[model samples]
Target chain A: MLDRDEDILKAAESWAEVDKGVALATVIETWGSAPRPAGSNLVVNEDGTFLGSVSGGCVEGAVVTEALDVISSGAPRMLEFGVADETAWTVGLSCGGRIRVFVEKVV
Target chain B: MKLATLSAINTERAARRPVIVVTDIGNGEQRLVRAADIARDPLHIELERHLRMGKSSVIEVEGRELFLNVYAPTAKLVIIGAVHISQALAPLARSLGYDVTVVDPRSAFASPERFPDVRLIAEWPDVALPPLNIDHYTAFVAVTHDPKIDDPALLHALERDCFYIGALGSRNTHGQRAVRLRAEGVSEASIERIHAPIGLEIGAISPSEIAVAIMAEITAQLRLPKASTA
Candidate 1:
């Protein structure tokens, strides 16, 4: 009965158990025309491998980049992206919506 | 956040008990709260509200953002007949993420070939329902068209807190069914909960269309607020 989110967390745990640095990103909030809903999760491994999604490919690359940093520094980071922001065009979230993703290293 | 906490959460989820994972985003501190422990938790009120709706949310508590990930057991659809509608409804419900179980005492109707990949119980309503563990997350549909079978199934569904109880029949047939239920001493409020005719008024003719209407009505009941008829 493990749902998709639980499976993502389990995957993160397994990755960490094998000495692969793992970071978990979760969608805390979304506004306007966001593709994914809140509470969606994405887990990243140290080798740049990942599972699940936060924004349905809208800002996953940016989140994964931040996740690698979180995995290295062991510090959590909250990322915001939207068409209203200047970074949105670069991050590819220009789909006309805002989303807040929290990335943390799984310890 | 400890790995043991995640393991505990998965254990509770496997057991089909509702659980909420409360995580502090600032410090990465996480705790697993079982449904029974919600009453003792500091965020009991918010946890209860989210649990009832079976949704997850992120809330700010005293300037610290905490994500409440609510994990309830998968909803179930207990159909009490193996008719054509059940054939369509089983896969439809499964596609909609419901754990479906088709119950009928007739072994020929509840055959494995008919309900492949679906759970089938060839037992009478009185014998099968109690073990099915029907709860508030369950949607019960009695479409047997036999009073002896459908009546007991409806009674069991009413006694439990099933979110939806639908019975298949025409208006006149339902009227007669109601009189019989009243004679059996079912409460007026409980009787009112039964959705006779079993589906939305979409003028559905085929079995699949009727299944669509039934699923739509059940979704409406599960997601929408009750309207005032007055």
Candidate 2:
């Protein structure tokens, strides 16, 4: 049966197939405030990926890391990034928000 | 790598997902179109209008040589309890086009005898969830207040990354439950994932009303563009 995540991933997959080799990222959890709620997803590919804004770009770098990891390992991971961190200044998100993402290889 | 699975419901194949497009027809415009088929296409166009407005509906599409309607499939709901609220929730969730599953460890409660058409599981979450492979597409609700049962299921859900994790309890129960979960080594952030007192504040006093509130919250959680549950 096609569940919502599967449907989103399917949508992302078709979008990527027309456009190829994209990385798929899913918002598994979120804290405080975020642009997308959990279960929302986006795909990133070699040239450029879908900018679904899982964490409003606040944690896209962390997600890119995990997306690349999935591309290489075929293993999925859950990632978390937020404004309440020493490195928050570098991340440029100061809204006291956090997002957890699960990146998986979308074949 | 999950391959996309599509419902074979479309009348014609498109290079991409087809969007229902409708063109208004004047009173004397194309009366040659069949009475039955005329409404089909126009209604589908109206459906597309609903979809564009952020409402879900079935719509018709019309192009030079093509005519059809697109129906986006609905989401699913997986409930981890066979409690009273769940009994009421199962049909409601199903009515919303959400595939529903009700899980419970107590055989007396989870038995198919009680929930005839519902997917009822008679095992603990550790035994059940692994096989189910709860994913982000799924919503996990723990209605059984028993910590021994609901906790392990929630752990599996957290690990599997279910989209929604709601537990039924009062303010006092949730506080102590948080302490227990913290003691179990669940991270502060992961512990925060739960939506305790599981339903919205609607002065719900009946099991059915509570079910409505929970489904409403789930709908809200699912619709939000970004997911932040703190």
lDDT of 1 by residue, B65-161 (tens): 8898788878899999998999999999999889999999999999989999999999999999999989878999999899998999998899998
- Which numbered prediction scores highest in lDDT against the true structure? 1
Per-residue lDDT tens digits for candidate 2, residues B65-163, read 121222223455778878888889999998876778887888999988778799887888888778776665577888888888888888888786666
Candidate 2 has an interface RMSD (Å) of 14.8
Q: Give candidate 1's root-mean-square deviation (CA, Å).
A: 4.2
Query: Using Cα atoms with residue i matched to residue i, what is each candidate's TM-score against the true structure?
Result: 0.75, 0.50
Query: For residues A1-107, what per-residue lDDT tens digits would candidate 2 score against the true structure?
Result: 22443454555656556745656665545677767665456666655555566766776776776686677676656566776666556774557777656566655
Model 2: residues with Cα > 4 Å off, grouped in runs? A1-107, B1-74, B227-230
Note the DockQ of each predicted structure: 0.35, 0.11
* Consecutive 10-residue window with the lowest summed lDDT within model 2 chain A: A1-10
**Model 1 segments beyond 4 Å from truth?**
A17-20, B87-96, B103-136, B147-162, B170-213, B224-230
Clashes of each: 0, 13
Q: Which CAPRI category fits model 1?
A: acceptable
Chain B TM-score for the candidates in order: 0.85, 0.69
TM-score of 1: 0.75
